[model samples]
Target: MDNKPLSFKGLRLLVVDDDPDTRKLISILFELDGAEVLTATSASEALEIILCFQPDVLICDICLPDEDGYSLLRKVKRLDIEQGRITRAIALSAYVMDEDRQYAYLAGYQKYLHKPINLDELAKAVNDLAQLQQYA
Candidate 1:
């Protein structure tokens, strides 16, 4: 577990997962770290939130209730490109297979994380994305 306290004071984050517990856990973690977090229980809701929130980073589960994370990310990517917004995404899944990871990258996720997520690592990843955005 990484103990480093990440600084994400003003970063906006969206967490999409069908499991309410997962969403709540991630939301709490990010909020504790100073990130403004929004959560969606399904892919469709996620898309709607994306349009309105325009979050800086999105952490999504691979297996969603309505649509898969790959499909969600693809749509999000299209919307981002169309609107000229840069929103980096991360794929979170219980599947740790190489094929799954590869597919996530092909679908436009910048990072892939397995479930039973380490909150510290997630914070670091979000912080890193925020830093990268600053450089970009």
Candidate 2:
């Protein structure tokens, strides 16, 4: 086995999705890229982890139990500003409407991913978000 660590080693990723399968799959995907991944099944759960983990990147589904992804995104941005922390975010959903994508970006997501997502795209998003953090 190669002893070298993966590119994302030590990076923290928080994935918020109400679907267990989706959450697990994304967590595994990020882990494979060497990130420490945290999964939440609801927006409230995600908020809790966001406060505690202070993840390097957030991958969030647009639909959630208590609130939608846009609401969650707003909460995250408010939390970061209140606490003086800056974090990058990616919005993931199956919506795929022009307005949906626009809403995500307007709510502060740096990038958007349509669901039934490609593993390669997810990996690249994580890497890109991490790189963005370095420059932010």
Candidate 3:
């Protein structure tokens, strides 16, 4: 699993998920990858963190206790526009339908990963997105 760190060296990341286990799992993944990671349990909490932290990337779950990830992303992007900030986003979800994927893209997620997270793929996604975002 390349578990010796460095997969995401120096990257600042925020993960939003209502599920405690999901948040902890994702947080640990990035943390082990050498990222400075933060977690939020809801969309509102995510926004709060974004304002103060201005993280390099956002890894979020589609189904949240407060709001859907789609709308949360819209809000995040809108704030980015207004504040001249950029936060690359990845959508994590249990929805495995093609339509769900389409919605994620339309909602502005740079990438999407279904449940049963793959560490390699997720790290690769962060790597690719970081390259595009110029953080890698």
Candidate 4:
């Protein structure tokens, strides 16, 4: 096993999903790894939290209650550019279609995570985004 220790401390991550169960699971995973996790069940709430937290990374579900993740991501991109907040974002969704992945990239997600996310992958994405933020 490549046992490189993972430290999620000091990383602020936002988990946006309408599914409570998935949100809870992902939140727990991130918390277990020592990250500051924020949850938003709706796009409006997410926008509010995003404004306040300005998280280092975003892990958003592609399908939301009010709006799709792409729309929200576009808003985030605008905010990031306008406010100079370069937070790296990732798309978390069950849709694993190649077109979906392409759309996510086009929508500005730095990474795309499948629904049943591997914990290791999730952790790595957070760490990588944190590093990218540090460098940015």
> Model 3 off-target regions past 4 Å?
1-6
**Clash list (residue pairs), candidate 1:** none
What is candidate 2's CA lDDT for residue 47? 92
Encode model 2's per-residue lDDT on 1-136: one tens digit a residue.
Answer: 4444338888999999888898888888778767899999889999999988999899999988899989998999999999888879989999999998998999999999998988778887778789888787
Residue 17 in candidate 3, Cα distance off native in Å: 0.6
* Weakest ten-residue segment in model 1 by summed lDDT: 1-10
Q: List, residue by residue over 1-136, the lDDT tens digit for candidate 4.
A: 6578878877899999998998898889878878899999977889999998998899999999899999999998898998987979989989999999999999999999997878789888877788889999
Clashes of 3: 0
Clashes of each: 0, 0, 0, 0
lDDT of 4: 0.89
User: Which 10 consecutive positions of candidate 4 have the poorest summed lDDT?
Assistant: 1-10
Off by over 4 Å in 1: 1-4
| Best of the two (1, 2) by TM-score | 1
Worst lDDT 10-window in candidate 2: 1-10
- Candidate 3's residue-wise lDDT over 1-136, tens digit each? 5455336889999999988887888788888768999999999999999988988889999999999999999999999999887889999999999999999999999999998889777888888788788843
Models 1 onward score TM values of 0.93, 0.92, 0.91, 0.93
Residue-wise C-alpha lDDT for candidate 1, range 99-132, written one tens digit per residue: 9999999988888889899886777778778888
